[model samples]
Target: MAANILLTRIDNRLVHGQVGVTWTKSLGANLILVANDDAAGDELQQKLMSTTADSSGAGIRFFTLEKTIKIISRAADRQHIFIVVKTPADARTLVEGGVPIKEINVGNMHFAQGKTEVTKKVYADAKDKDDLLALANSGVKIYIQDYPGDKQYPITDDLLSKVE
Candidate 1:
């Protein structure tokens, strides 16, 4: 069986109870890659996330952004890999660094103190909108999805609306 990645998601609350109990199973995730520099550096957080990465021996990995970009660009697996990032900045970094991805799934971006819009499953602020737009123009599909199984709204949809 060729291992593949199911979804690359951005969620600050990485490996929370929902992830451990629900998302993993619902998505049939066999690997969870926590690609956040801070999270990977913190020993305690790493241990905690590891515990939640699952008891099923699904390979759990944590990589700094640079390393992750290299790894994802080269990876070819069929077993589902579920990546969790803490923020959109990380997403931007990966794309800007030229990681080969066509789309990104946004999941549960918590309300910060900026401009607001709860579009579908994501809470997007003004800056988030700007970033998403940039990625969209670059041909990346930025989407709103709280879980892997959730229905998605492609950023392209919004782009089309504005043009019309």
Candidate 2:
């Protein structure tokens, strides 16, 4: 069976309960790929995410952005894959690196210094806005929805214009 990309999402908190259970179940994904540079090399993070994925009864894989870009094609053809990235930049990188992503969901991004609040659950700084703009320009649809049953808010140029 050729695995297809079920969904791609950007969430700082990668493999938590909502994602492991709700998202996986709703999407009918058998595999979850958490692609983030920091988490991939961190043994502690890997184990934690793996445990979460296990609890959800989904096969999980962890890889840095580069490694994911390199292996995404092969992985996608193997099982239904749900990809989770840590940031907008990471999603842009994946698309640029040939991941064939057409849409992305913004789940959660914590508030940080210098970031303007884009939504109750998302914050964006300059680089993040830039990355998101690039992704939009490249024909990738971006939306914010923390869960499968939530209403989706599409990311628009008008929205970005008001972020400052």
Candidate 3:
């Protein structure tokens, strides 16, 4: 059985060209679950996104993690799956909700208002940092990276070292 799930990443852009052309190939998970609630509802947006994310052969399911968690948990015919979350809260929610997360990759949180100190290519706001700490406490490994093959920046250390 191949990996049931391979990569879990947080990228706001979701399934972009770079992601499709790179991450999916690297992680060996062509199937992606985009865990966003609002994005799941807007039919029009979903249609547009689906068009962009579709790799013709690769399978991409854009749905809320809450909706797909059960299905994923039950599936046995192993598939490489990459879960994409929009925010740190969403990632934390999944972990707190009982999803078995081995590792989560923070690709690009980008710069935003109300965020904390910028370090390297990653930025963590209060909520984001709290989630990092929570996951760390729970023993989930986190790697802050910009791209699939990029060097990882451990968010745990970043937060601890910079926290006042």
| Candidate 3 Cα outliers beyond 4 Å, as residue runs | 1-3, 160-164
Candidate 2: tens digits of C-alpha lDDT, residues 139-163 = 8888889889889988887777756
In terms of lDDT, which candidate is strongest? Answer: 2
- 1 versus 2: better lDDT goes to: 2
Candidate order by lDDT, highest to lowest?
A: 2, 3, 1
lDDT for 153 (candidate 2) = 86
Query: Could you tell me which 10 consecutive residues in candidate 3 have the lowest summed lDDT?
Result: 155-164
Residue pairs with colliding backbones in model 2 are: none
* Per-prediction TM-score to the true structure, in the order listed: 0.78, 0.94, 0.85
What lDDT tens digits, residue by residue, belong to model 1 across residues 16-111?
766764777777888888889998889899888788776645667889998888767556666577777777778788778776656577777775
Rank the models by TM-score, top first: 2, 3, 1
lDDT of 3 by residue, 1-164 (tens): 23377778887777677665478777877577777898778787667656655763457777786876555676455556778888778888888877777889888777677665545556667677777778777888887777766677776654556543
Better of 1 and 3 by TM-score: 3
Question: Stretches of candidate 1 above 4 Å error?
Answer: 1-3, 74-79, 156-164
Candidate 3 all-Cα RMSD? 2.5
Angstrom error at residue 149, model 3: 2.2
